[model samples]
Target: MNYINKITLLFLLSISVSFAQEKLSKEDAINLALENNYGIKIADSNLKIAKNNKSILNSGYLPTLTGNAGATYNKDNTEAIFANNEVSILKGAKSNRFNASLNLNYTLFDGLGRLYNYKQLKEQYNLTELQARETIEKTLLQLFTVYYKVALLTENVALLTQSLKISKDRLTRVNYQFEYGQNTKLFILNAEVDVNNDSIALLNTNQLLLNAKRDLYVVLGKKENPNFYVDTQVNFLTKLNKQELFGQVKTNNVSLLQIQRGIEISSFQLKANKSGYLPTIGLTTTYGWSKSNNNSASFLLESTNTGLSTGFNFKWDLFNSGRTRTQIQNAKINYDIQQLSKQQKELEITRDFNNAWEEYKTKLFIFQTQEKNVETNKRNFSRTEEQFKLGQITSIEFRQAQVNLLNAQSNLNSAKYDAKNTELKLLQLTGDLLNTEF
Candidate 1:
């Protein structure tokens, strides 16, 4: 009674756990990644930096003010002469003074460096945003892969377990017959071996499930949050065919957007470099006060006053050892590299679409064919067992029949999973996997 109660309790607990595991949805996974993924964090930090740079770039357009203060003491020993050239004895004297002034500086111009820098920063902002999207897509891809793998493994373990139960029932019947001297012992041994193998497979599957769960935590960016359970509700998105998959890749693929942003950034860099050749002009202003003490009577000798002035300045780089030309060349080279990368990416995407399409077709065929194979094998195994009971088939033959049935079932499961994975991959390749309908 105690063993039976414990078993029942364990079964109930397992069911509750499964229900809990299934509660996580795809949207939950995406939101978790966006909030916690390391890549997304880095991208967000870069965006902050770009915004700060943009703000600093505009500072040159504003005026700057400064204040100053000082205190000094001076000692002098000298003789004073009368108007008639009569000399008198000299004495040492010290004078103390205090002074302060305020000055302001404003840029008249700097060859438009400020404007170009601002433009560059703006472009960088776009790049950082694209980078964030890239991280998001990559994170999503990893989540999809791990989640489906876990789901497939879980289903497989369940199927195999059901198979083991059926095999166990057959073994029990065979044992009953053997006690009556109506069945061979070899049949029992074979069943035992098969059950042992199935147990081993189940153990391995469980380990894999654990590993997949750990990966899920990583993809969700929750290394420190162990108590957070994942939602594993999954559905194979259907209604996607090769016909419409590729059509969306160019428009919706995050990688393609990043490539386009790269192009825009390179264009802006080129423009910035070209602007260096032109002269920069700007306006400036300075206001301050001054005073001087040149004699012992410092309080009587002074020129204390304040004034304000405004003027413009121009700077032209006439000769710079071809630095501007070199910079322009560098910019052009970077542009060429980006363009080439875009072309290469296009080709790679095309190849991916073609491969995914062919794979989808292959899996579909296998899925259809395996269904018939499972049905046929099911009948064959059952008939072979009846023949063994009548002493018409050898134990070896019956064991082979069992193996065939198991293999068929395994293959059929594999085919189903393959079909699902290929279909999802094809949609992703065509850049429409995450569309609202899917």
Candidate 2:
């Protein structure tokens, strides 16, 4: 049993040594995640595609030009007879033909369809940008949540270590008292038991700290957990105004902006679909060169033509089995749907913001209360220790005081982190997280 205990102690010591090698600040962790996180990379790629799609060529604002060339060769046997009873026979006759052309087509008018299409493209690009920003916001929220969890656990471990130290000191003092015939064997055994309990608590907290660090590494997109420590202090905004935050949410929230853009895009789609009712006019021009040779022809042996031709083309869907009407109706319905979605999203965001704000305020109050409790417990423990030394308190009473202080400290640490996390949630709802300095 002693051997197993020694092995466990050594393993924990090794982990502690590894974890203390370097320090990682919150900003450094955020930067690492932005550079390596898979979700951010994918969002950036999508934004690039949306940007590329918002172009004149893709929106039908540019003319299309095409060049074509081809050559043909043929061989045949032919026989000819004339009305004057004259016959001619030709063998191995060969013919060759070549043609090339450059064609240009431009839309002269499409009942403003092209204009609406271009506007839709622009709105789509804006929507994608907002989507990417939302992705970043979400990723940062996750990163910070894990980062602070590690910080919280790190602080817990430190508190547990301090508690264990006090236990060990108490046990040593009890042993001395027992040797001097000032304390009973029962007192010594109780002290030893308290020491073991503190040791177990420390061990359990250390294990939790290690696990939290591993989770942080995963959030950082790291393949392996490195030997590093995080900042144990958690800082949060303390002076946020509710009205100002709500105003920012109205203007800066990514989800709201995306929904607004969707509505505009839908409106454009309805306009573009209505354009199907009007005639489409286009301009077409072609410059061509052709050459041909026929060995079996008597009157015309070789011929060539080169010219430029231009024309105007018109197309109107006079009757398309009511397809145009159906499309227009569908587009109008879609536009309505988008408007409803915008309203729904607005209500949802407002609800979420209200909830987060209330939670932040509540957590802040709890943290403040816990802070006072820790101060009070510290004083109580100090007095209890002095009383124990003067023989005014029992070992169990001193141990209880020590445990109370430890619990108070632990609760304070937890409340501090919880309040900080709630503040982050509020910032996220207002779309202020990315701009806030950690």
Candidate 3:
């Protein structure tokens, strides 16, 4: 067995090993991210907290009930002189008292502040939901970016592997021709140099492939490098319409929705602040009982009392040193800020969508052009190979054709993945990424 045969055998063994590793599909990768990614988990927890906050209790709609009880004991010696010139002396005087009360208070009105607060909480919950979704959209975008990158590198490695095989074959032919006195030592040296160059390229690409796979593992929340292979097929959505995408962006963009929710929340805050100017009316009810016992008393040694009372209370903040006025003013200003922010965000999203749309179109076009270029290079390399075997073409020309074919294939691979990434971005901008079937 020769050196080339050994190299080929080793390459085949490695390929077989790679094939034995588990194939992680794109859908599986996405599902794993959703299930286990830390960012997604944190977002989900925050969303749950927001959901839990949306309750009447948090809005102050419920009444407050409280109970109190106490007991006291006293011991003392007393000497008392009566008005009839009689002296009465009492020793070891003892007294005990017990008291208990239950009080209930309910706010009947506060300029509808409770209602506005509840609405605010609802809006906050909605905002949190949108924020979580945005997190998901961003995470999915990152995932796909890395996923396609791995795919590109995977295909590049394959192409380099094939290129290396061609170089090695050319070197073997050169060696045979040199042994038969048909080729010069310079030709054999050139062929050997090309083989080494191809080997280096393949090694470097394999390293990139490894690093990309590691990134994929991290995104999937895997603690270890699983050394798994990814599906190189990147699916692209080519029929996306600009007008339809813009429509979706206006209505469904997560960031836009969050801003709209912020506007509503600010509106509620303004209303709540305005409520502070009006009188607060409430109902209060109380039930009480008390008992007392005294030893060494002539007449009224024991006493007990019980009572129930109910009343309505009203309080108007006639003036708070302009505090309420200041709060209302601030709330109004915040509401205006939110409105302006919404407008700005709308413009920004529209611009991003436009850029991504144009990029997708351009990348797709480049991909098509590269596809044709690769086919042409492949045919040209085939004819060059035949001519070189017939001694009609120089080794340098043959090497140039080989390099051209390799580069064309590499460019095609890169363009394909780049176009796919742009497509994903468009989907994300339109809020259709999560809903679109992969």
What are the per-residue Cα lDDT tens digits for candidate 1 across 256-279? Answer: 777877887787788778877988
The number of the candidate with the highest TM-score is 2
For candidate 3, the lDDT comes to: 0.89
Check candidate 1 and list the clashing pairs: 24-231, 108-281, 108-282, 108-283, 109-281, 109-282, 111-280, 245-430
lDDT of each: 0.71, 0.87, 0.89
Question: How accurate locally is residue 377 in candidate 2, as Cα lDDT from 0 to 100?
Answer: 98
Clashing pairs for model 3 are none
lDDT tens per residue, model 2, 1-438: 663256348547866696557888988999998988888889999999998899876989899999999999988787877677888788888899999999999999998999999999999999999998998999988888888888888887778778877887887888898999998999988987777777777677767877888888887878886678888876777689999999998988889998999999999999998898999999999999999998764557899999999999999988899998999999999999998998899899999999999999999999999999999999999999999988899999999999899999989988998898889888988989899988
TM-score rank, highest first? Answer: 2, 3, 1
The prediction achieving the highest lDDT against the true structure is: 3
TM-score of each: 0.81, 0.95, 0.94
* Candidate 3 lDDT by residue in tens digits, 140-179: 9999898888889889989999999889889989899999
Model 3 TM-score, all chains together: 0.94
